[model samples]
Target: MTDHADLLELAVEVAREAAALVTERRRAGVEVADTKTSPTDVVTEVDHAAEELIRDRLLAARPDDGIVGEEGDDTPSTSGVTWVVDPIDGTVNFLYGIPQYAISIAAKEGDEVVAGVVLDVTKGEAFTATRGGGAHLDGRPVRVRDVVPLEHRLVITGFSYQRETRVKQAAAIARLLGRVRDVRRLGSAALDLCYVACGRADAYVEEGLNEWDLAAGGLVVEEAGGRWAQRPGVGGKRLVLASPAGGFDDFVAAVEGCGFTAS
Candidate 1:
């Protein structure tokens, strides 16, 4: 067994419990929602509520660990352990009853992610990984697909809600649409990366993601034999995620033609 696996066990437990709370509230009925930064960027009560639940449980379990979450802040410490969280990764979808959101939690040592979990609240799917141990979906080990040819790939991507960012992403989407099997914008970067890890979606690209949004999902993709890079996008720290063993070169070539590079 590995150290991350132990941490993963605890993370999985916390993430699933948070997911159940989200699903239960979603089923009851949603109240109206509002924007966070812009009108197009939506957030629901469930996001903050779930964050509170996950934050409390995780901090209680390990009081010394630092936390960085979408809804709140926990200062960095010298303890070398920090939990990065995006309690509800697709709050817009969750609010609209679209059923594609997730609870993303990650535990990191220093600057590296050691263990992480992404819980698909609507589907009851849990995707997890531990550094150097490999990635898994519901206890079954998973890996990236071995397909070649960008034209044959199913890529997933998303845009920032900001106006200028959305415009650039739209152009990029138009550039890639004609050359691939298909492109999807699922609205949940966490689930999108899990899709890349489990080989459901061959690749995922995103911009305007904070550290908490990409940390866990990035580790899952890496442990599953995938690749991850930070590309310049809306805010210049957007994440470009794919499989290193699964088509890294081609993914890079395809994406670079559109002028995205690490920020």
Candidate 2:
């Protein structure tokens, strides 16, 4: 538990630092803009600056750990401790002046995530989790809501950047929206899953996420007594679904109709 606690501390510190960098850059102004894959996928000066800030802090503290970042190259780690980062989880939101984005960081031992942090820079809110120690929001313990019924369930989701995939993803959301109490596309997956962890959102699902995007928030959701899985009858890449333990079955049922890739 001590090591886990220490890891959480380190991740929290690194995330906060990254968040500060994001804040400073966002407030100062985003001068340089670049697009990836499509016009919708974006990277700005802040994302690169924030990732460098995170890499410096994390690698300096634990030099042996490998680091993988959304905005940077993968540096393979020999120590089996890999630190994954999404410097700006919602760059589109950030660039457009939306405050729903977050900074995500997680450390994995082998394939298992041992520590995680999601910092909502706009709100100065932080969520942290360790493998067995449970999840926390601003240093206080937090857990998922126990919402169960479809009529009462609130869900959050994200769409893919690929045009064809986005159309399919939209149709699935349309069906789900009519069945659920309500649905939202928050743009920031890290904050959305953190919301699920702390009972702010009942459940969340998304497709085509890289490790950096889901690592911290997924672990946080698990630590907060939520369950994680691929949509029923769907493979790992189809959709990553997560909900409170009490709402798991309903969530699975709601997403059962999604068009997903085969395992």
Candidate 3:
């Protein structure tokens, strides 16, 4: 039997180690390693270094498990388990010396994510979850906040690096602002989901999130007694959505009405 807790433990361990390396490197200064999708969509030397560190540690721990990382090529699994890694989600924030980036890691058996961790590089906060186990922050159990009314729900989101997508997202946000309590654009998707998981926010929705970006944090949100979903949206990208269960259906309706998912 695949032990989900075992996977979660390994993910948390590797993620913390990678976070340390990232923090150490950021202190030395940052250099742009490359860009993806758009010029503003950057990858840094620290990003590559951290990802390699994570991949190496994870593979050393579980030799037969596959790896899918933001900064490296995919490694197929013989053990039926794959690790999804985002070496530094919110790399732009990291480059700007903002304290919101994270090391995200998740383990999946087949297509189902079984375990996950999102370690905040700057805050030293660890958000973790397993398939049946509940979500936790710093080892204490956590849950999403009770239902907030539509006009008072604090919605969080991210914009695409591409200008066209950002333009559309802005339009959606403009429409959404009047209906919700407020909105925040926090560069990191992983942390945004975790924020909702721990009741720091009431909901999160974003389009164009890659699998590595969503895997660990999405699992955390689900395990926290919250709800999430994804569907085709503008540019054919997946419009990821999440909220406390009480507000999810209404939040989705609001998101759609505001053109968040309009093609």
- Model 1 residue runs over 4 Å out of place are 32-34, 234-239, 244-246, 259-263
The per-residue C-alpha lDDT of model 3 at residue 140 equals 100
Per-residue lDDT for 1-263 in model 3, tens only? 67999998888888889999999999999999999999999999999999899999999989999999989999999999999999999999999999999999999999999999999999999999999899999999999999989999999999888898889889999999999999998899999999999999999999999999999999999999999999777756889999998889999999999998865
- What CA root-mean-square deviation does each model show from the true structure? 2.2, 2.3, 0.8
Q: In model 2, which runs have C-alpha deviations exceeding 4 angstroms?
A: 231-238, 258-263
| Full-model lDDT, candidate 2 | 0.84
The TM-score of candidate 1 is: 0.93
Worst 10 residues of 2 by lDDT: 230-239
* Candidate 2 structure quality by residue, lDDT tens digits, 1-263: 22777888998888888887788878888854687767778889888889999999988988888999998888899778899899999988999899899999998988899999999989989899999899999989998997767778888988877787787777777788877789899899889889999998888888877788889999999999998876432323547888998878767766875443333
**Error of model 2, residue 13, in angstroms:** 1.0
- Candidate with top TM-score is 3
Each prediction's TM-score versus the true structure: 0.93, 0.93, 0.98
Q: Total clashes, candidate 3? A: 0
lDDT of 1 by residue, 186-207 (tens): 9899989889889898877777
Clashing pairs in 3: none
Ranking by lDDT, best first?
Answer: 3, 2, 1
